[model samples]
Target: GKVPILLPPLPEQKKIAQILSTWDQAITATERLLENSQQRKKGLMQLLLTGKKRLPGFEGEWETRKLKELCAIKTGKKDVNEGNPDGKYPFFTCASEPTGSDEYSYDCEALLIAGNGIIGKTHYFKGKFEAYQRTYILSDFSNAVSVSYLHQFILYWLMRDIDREKQHGAMPYIKLGLLQRFNVFVPSIEEQQRIAMVLSYADQEIDGLEFKLNLLKQEKKALMQQLLTGKRRVNVETEAA
Candidate 1:
């Protein structure tokens, strides 16, 4: 148990509580919207990536193929120290921020899939980049499947697997062979591009909503700092001259 805390006088307490309540309500609403948008994106990925829902004008059965048949896979060459802080290329690692590097092992559209820590997380990138040894870089997709479509579909598949079976042991790890042998249902190039385009637009909407949520949170933080410290006052309507 803990000791009870002191409180401000009645009027000031009521005013502060009222003002903070409005902000709390706003934050809750924004969070709900964000949750709904995220769920919608997941639903879209499940449908589009699995070929359960086809875009208009799309006909013919989707071909099922292993990942190795579609793209080339490889691990990175550069060590941790080899990465540069102020370099032109992206050096991906298991960490949150991608390291920078002057040199690159691959220079084309690729998916950087975390093979060790934060395993199954994937990043889609086009252009020159470097990767950590444990990270798997997949590129050079075939004409049957667009790179963008494959990237999204693979990520969706990984998400499903990771969600069901969380970790392998103490650390989650993905093997190159597992990634290579992964099976996927792919539509024609035209249909794949169409699905990718729709998902991309959906991503844009989610991004916009998330940005708004962040702004609201920042605003609320600033307000709490100002109000609680008595730096700013809540100017409630009053019967005064």
Candidate 2:
């Protein structure tokens, strides 16, 4: 049996629905904007990583290298109990949980790749943080061929290869050896920075927009609950017949 909708009188129902419809329209518009931005970001990544799009003041061919050639995979400490209450360090795990400790493990900016169950997930850690054993830290960026460029490159490569490597009956895992053999497209440092910056900006904007949309949705939901329940009513004067 279909649940009956406790709609108000015809005119009031129309008004309530109209208000909700306006909110829906705003949500739809915001969602479309987010999608467009994401699509553009993807396009930028394709062009920038492939060297087809060159940012102003940058000129050079990109170099190619394997993951091991550019970074040393450092595993995090395994002591979960080592978390300190007074410690002031950020903790990271394969699941992106910040629930470990406040101690510095690797003191530098490098890309962190999930090495075990949630393999190939990449995070750029720029501050002091404690990382879980299941996570692998990338260090030695300064001496590498192109650290920043390779950082983004590995992300793109992982995005492409992760699903293909996930086999049924076997847990998804990214072996360090496999990462070592993974090919990377390295652009000049300047170009690499440019591309990373552009993509990062897009991501930030998307996050901000999503946050705003969520807030707006919550507000709309609250309004609907109150208005639909007859707890709040809009004033509508009727003329004498």
Candidate 3:
């Protein structure tokens, strides 16, 4: 048996190859930008969350406290199966996007953590939201710890816990007791606000880059459809322009 191949004329095939290669290079460049931005975010988390880095407007050492001391933790009342697709409120089942909810269990600035499936994932949101019974909700933040700062701290350290869990090869789960005992470093409320602001800006920048990447991908997809089908032919001399 012989391998299959496209039978376009040599010149036309070469033109198509060159055009596709250009698109591939563009996509690869945007992908690299996305990866770099994500890495920068992780680096920022290490420095800012640990109090190793500080914003210019504020200065002070961070306090050490258990996770429970910063906020209260409780599991949701509804099970994952209880979520309704057409409900009005946001209903979180696990780590991914939330379903719709007719009612909400809490309405505040809170952190949502997965307790079972795809565990250790976390979400922070303001206003009303519903959660699965296995979803751990951390709300009623303490005055000593800024909620956003605390969210960052958890986001930073949760990676370590995830890595450790991978070593065990056991099902991922977040025990309420374990979270209650987990400790974190906390700066003054004002300093926390500044750190959160900086990180928020970083996230926005990364998000903007992602949007551009998506547009580039869409453009390439449309271009391929036109070029491959010969609906929009590319002139070899156009490359010079």
**Residue by residue across 38-107, what tens digits does model 2's lDDT show?**
8877787788878888889988666778777777777788555677646687666666445546567668
Residue 67 lDDT, candidate 3, scale 0-100? 88
Model 3: CA > 4 A from native: 1-8, 236-241
lDDT, candidate 1, equals 0.81
lDDT of 1 by residue, 39-145 (tens): 89889998888878878888788889999999888888777788898989899987666879998888888888887767777888888898988888888778888
| Clashes per model (N, Cα, C within 3 A) | 0, 0, 0
**Better TM-score candidate (2, 3):** 3
What would the TM-score be for candidate 2 when compared with the true structure? 0.79
Question: Each model's C-alpha lDDT?
Answer: 0.81, 0.74, 0.81
TM-score of every candidate relative to the true structure: 0.86, 0.79, 0.85
Clashes of 1: 0
TM-score of 3: 0.85
The window of 10 residues in a row where model 1 has the poorest summed lDDT is: 232-241
